[model samples]
Target: MIRQRVIVHGRVQAVGFRFSARVEAQRLGVSGWIRNRNDGAVEAEIEGEAASVDAMLAWLDEGPPGAEVTSLSTADLAPTGERGFRVLS
Candidate 1:
């Protein structure tokens, strides 16, 4: 399993990014949580098989239709065996 902490910038807030990410993560069998950062960025931690995680990261670049993802930053993390994906307040 692989895990990553991703920070997505630009037009991410108030654009349904979190919900869309949760849906995609679930579909990819990824586990983690996503939330809006105070810096106007969307932050998430995803854990799953390498292929699934990679797919998730790629999807984050596109995000929801209304979302305009300008850039993405990711960091490798140790898996915590997390289950399910969620949107955090």
Candidate 2:
């Protein structure tokens, strides 16, 4: 398993991005946390199997219905061994 930190840009906040991420991550059996950044973006840390991690990254591209995901930037990170996905306030 591996971890990735993704920063979603453009029309992400207040548009259900974090909520959708929570659901998607759980469904994919991923463990991580998602929250809004002060710079008007949504940041997330996801860890799981390789295939599942790829799936999550792809989902972040489109995001939720109301979200206008302009783009997403990701970086590799050491696995945190997180247990569940959460929407951090």
TM-scores for all candidates: the values are 0.98, 0.97
Give the Å error, residue 49, model 2.
0.3
**Candidate 1 lDDT, tens digit per residue, 1-89?**
99999999999999889998999999999999999999999999999999999999999999999999999999999999999999999
What is the Cα-based TM-score of model 2?
A: 0.97
Candidate 1 regions with alpha-carbon error over 4 angstroms = none
Clashing pairs in 2: none
What TM-score does candidate 1 get on C-alpha atoms? 0.98
| Candidate of highest TM-score | 1
lDDT of 2 by residue, 20-59 (tens): 8899998999999999999999999999999999999999
Top of the candidates by lDDT: 1
